[model samples]
Target chain A: MNPLPRIPSPRNPAPLTIADLGEQGLLQRLQPFCAPGVVGDDGAVLQPSPGQALVVTTDTLVEGVHFSATTTPPEAVGWRSAAANLSDLAAMGALPLGLTVALALPSTCSVAWLEGLYQGLAQCVGDYGTAIVGGDLCRAPHLVVSITALGEVPPPLVLKRNAAQVGDAIVVTGYHGASRAGLELLLDPDRALTGLCPPSPQQRDQWIRAHQYPRPRLDWVPWLRSALAQGQSASASRSFAAMDSSDGLADAVLQLCRASGVGAHLVQADLPLPPGLASWQGLATALDWTLYGGEDFELVLCLPETVLAGLEAASGAGVPAFGLRRVGTIVAGSQVTLHGSDPQEPGRVLSLDRGFQHFSELF
Target chain B: MNPLPRIPSPRNPAPLTIADLGEQGLLQRLQPFCAPGVVGDDGAVLQPSPGQALVVTTDTLVEGVHFSATTTPPEAVGWRSAAANLSDLAAMGALPLGLTVALALPSTCSVAWLEGLYQGLAQCVGDYGTAIVGGDLCRAPHLVVSITALGEVPPPLVLKRNAAQVGDAIVVTGYHGASRAGLELLLDPDRALTGLCPPSPQQRDQWIRAHQYPRPRLDWVPWLRSALAQGQSASASRSFAAMDSSDGLADAVLQLCRASGVGAHLVQADLPLPPGLASWQGLATALDWTLYGGEDFELVLCLPETVLAGLEAASGAGVPAFGLRRVGTIVAGSQVTLHGSDPQEPGRVLSLDRGFQHFSELF
Candidate 1:
């Protein structure tokens, strides 16, 4: 068998190894992101906010299975792990506070690589004011990093999975399919000229960075929470069912419906597709990517029809800024339907094979 | 090359895969150890006590590096992982409340095996009053389980590694070396008849169980807290430094000394050995294990001479009735010495070829 290929060191003045990185390296990377009350050592400490509850979530990334060793950088892996957990916190409209990371690395792994990974993780945490508090170190057959994040939600602001109602109008944040486009670029580099993948170095960098460090929608939490709390009517306040979309819009919408025990109707014309993909063929491909691609980390929300006014009021103030657009609505049935043109001629809802199945395809 | 040996299924029932066990089965198994507020879908929710702080810790166990697939059962691996983290909590005199588990399994791994592992983990959690809160599941090259446990301690009751003072007496809870002896038995099963190993089936079972599922000394937390609250002199309360002896007594003493900036003098004759291992050769072997073997999971505590009465008053009534012994005294310098009859003549301190190293060794 061929010997394992060595990972290249970052182009810098000095290189470091796993031992050299140590606890200090981790602390340096995470310290900037930590909130005032969260401290490091045992775990990130979150002082209880008087009227809020703490929301915690965890996600793990394994080498090879999650991403090929040759294709994905350690820094991207670190960033993604933090982003994934933060996404969960954002889904609950919670303020990200701190995180603990447990890392398992092969003995031969260099310290420099680990340090770079921390750099990426630190960048994300710092961006969101989340501290890297505590974690474990161990040897393993392959590289694995598990991160648990803690966030706080004011009692009145907590969004749960089971809060959607039959008449709720569904809205989503941000554009979709960019990460999926980036994935296609990585998997088939030759597909660049087709406009499916960007060709220039700058474009490549943008795509790669998007794949590696997609931001969590934490900034939108306050606006969403405020709108939900107004509570004049479902439409008067901003309250509705909300969750982050990680495993693509299709799966996320399906999950929301399942939790609410209702069905949904998707308006194809309302989707926010990325630039330059306009023709039906192009749109269909992009839609496929948008529907089932993973790691978008945006929010898919269900708002009561009464709260539509509150959502519109928030949008008018440029609060959500990108603005929430209606993509679907909850109905009385148990299946997600896609609407084309005429109400009498509803189009067949296109279903892609499962999105990202972590351990098994069963889910 | 020969194919890897298949994991053995128990004789009485066909092995169940993780899918077969589902969420409820795994939760049911883990429910016993967790307090009412511990488990939740988002993550375990722990309520911090008044004037108390939360202590969080995480550790991961991999299939081959942490345990041998053939020799160690999956259940033991799961149980020990929880035990190890809880031990850290106990060292701080904290009560464990909840834990989140992230599991990475190869696609071919059986669901039943995962169920058994959860059963073991759940048993330990139930025993500790820790709830299973939340976790991530993913596919990987080998089995990997990462657990994060949350614990609480009154601020005044928190014991730290840096509190040992010169002239403080060193105390240890429970007997040492049994785990090392059991490990020796596992490595060389044919040595069962030797006095170095357990002599009977019952003794052997006990030894193995102790190694596999050692209980964290959480019962001592309340007693330690009470001792702290009684306003004993600084020479008594402030002098106490505590940490778990996970990496054998000598190493633990070395770490405690490093943390406290002091040395210690151990009485070789006072080193407690497991019962029935008193013969000259057996005692020597047991002593070696006690000094250098890993995974004892007992507490090594340092306190002033004045608190001996308080400790004695609390023992057996709350603390485990087993071997709590005075083994050494803290000194002003930075050396750890083993003392014999001649206090003036320095005793020879034993050294091992290597200390316990994780992951890197395998690679």
Candidate 2:
């Protein structure tokens, strides 16, 4: 039998990795941040809330596809990974109950990086009043984080895509494209902003932060529910359909319309571009990016026109804080049309840019 | 901008890949297999069972790590992945409610392969009386499947790892070592059986089937509860602790002991070897593999001494079917010891093999 030569890694002496800690040690590191008494069990036991239904959403983020390992901070990657799932639950008007993070790590991944990643996941989950209840760890060629977030909402308020009425007002909770721009800057920090009407350094930094740490719209849910409830009569049932624009605004709009069997008329002039975008539209194409770029983690909602009057008057809570902007209306046709600034002219059918195709595309 | 020359393939214009389908087309493919009315929404809504606590567990299986892309069939891969997580819920004595499957696929993955994978996943999930409630798909350099299984159990019967008493009898449902031996054959089908005292062809086939299609002990759960209840009077409380042997029997025993804060005395003669393992113990080291080799997917349980007499008499349903074997007894201490066939000899401390460390090793 021939024995292979052993080559010890001595030159650079890289940082301590998860491999060095082993499963038990790595679990020990995680137990403190995860939900108390949840990590040691066969599975996390969550008591069901009476009269409420449970909502579950899952999302996966791969190392190179979702965030560049070398360029992006580990904690920010963790934050964004968790935010993606939490945003889905928030879109359904469910408050988070807990989360289970399943990670597949590479041998080269450092323990410090893992710690920072968990810290980010825990912080985002904790910020929304939930804990990391359970998780599984294993090996892979690259880093992969799959988070399944469990949330709860009353059965009546459990939002669905098909609930939008024909006379619904299309709304957005916040600005868009900042996350895409942030991603561009992060990928090529010194270069991606060279086009006409580049964002200021401060604006670029904000965009970077938006991309790195986009918060889920969980805080806006309670306020919206309360605000909408106030406007309706005692016996009238009320509902507003919503979906997160993680796959860009156009994609979300198209999905909502398709699911609801309705059409949407998006007004160009009323587009809620990130601050200062209206002034700088020529060479930058920021408006195009704003409408098409994804990962904003903002909710695109549809409120019934009848309740719109009441909701507008019932505001002050979630209204000013999240900057809910009325973008368009749900029309009768099935096509999503974009109307120009001129009121007399007919609208053009919006072309669909395929968003985030698995196996072929990346963010 | 110079466009790269399009090199068209003339020979072997391969089958339809997931890239050709895109994300929307892929969702359309998955919609039917997933839970009815659960897909096409921001998140899945599950009506919580009355008076039942929810149990959640997650597990991941990566290509080349958990399953071989070339050797293992895609459907088998899917079945094994779901089984891994389902086993966790089964160990906790919970009835599955639903599951969320998040997959990260490579460009090379074919749509046919994906359909088969989902079919396998759906079959296993459906067999256990649940559906794939939600899922997310994205691009990755390799095939990755992360499944989060949700379950429900009455609060009192929420089997946890910490409920074992000092005098509890350690029991295992079904056999062990077959999964490891099966893996051995699958990895090197031609040469793995060359060692001393290899099994018959039928036995080999059985072992391989065990590896590819191991079922979760969900069927045994109901019987377990009823059996334990039969011994206790109307007033006395009854419960047992359990954990899956996915990380091998020894690892499961060690973990159950560590989590419950009790030591165990494993009888060497009483170890539940898979059908032909005890006979093939010399060069093949089947007993060693039985104890240390992981991915068995059987449940290791701890039943109170008082209930043992009743449970033994309370058989006929899950007993003969799954071959429930009593292998050890829980003792007061922190160390897990293995006693020799000669009961007079003092037992020796069992050395830990550090089962299934991520990023460092693979089966």
Assess each prediction's global lDDT (C-alpha) against the native.
0.70, 0.80
For candidate 1, the TM-score is 0.87
Cα-based TM-score, every candidate: 0.87, 0.92
Point out where model 2 deviates above 4 Å: A1-14, A191-201, A227-239, A278-284, A310-315, A359-363, B1-14, B190-198, B228-239, B281-284, B313-315, B359-363
Per-residue lDDT over B94-200 for candidate 2, one digit per residue giving the tens place of the 0 to 100 score: 88999999998886688778887887788788878888999988889888899999999878777888877788899998788888888887877874456556677
* Cα lDDT tens digits for candidate 1, A92-118: 878876788888877666665676677
Q: Give the CAPRI rating of model 1.
A: acceptable
True contacts kept of 2: 0.80
Which number leads on TM-score? 2
Clashes of each: 25, 0
Q: Report the C-alpha lDDT of model 1 over B203-322, residue by residue, as the tens digit.
A: 555566668877788877777766656635443445357888876888778778877889898998888676654552376676777787778888898887666557767654555668
- Cα miss at A352, model 1 (Å)? 8.9
Model 2: CAPRI class: medium
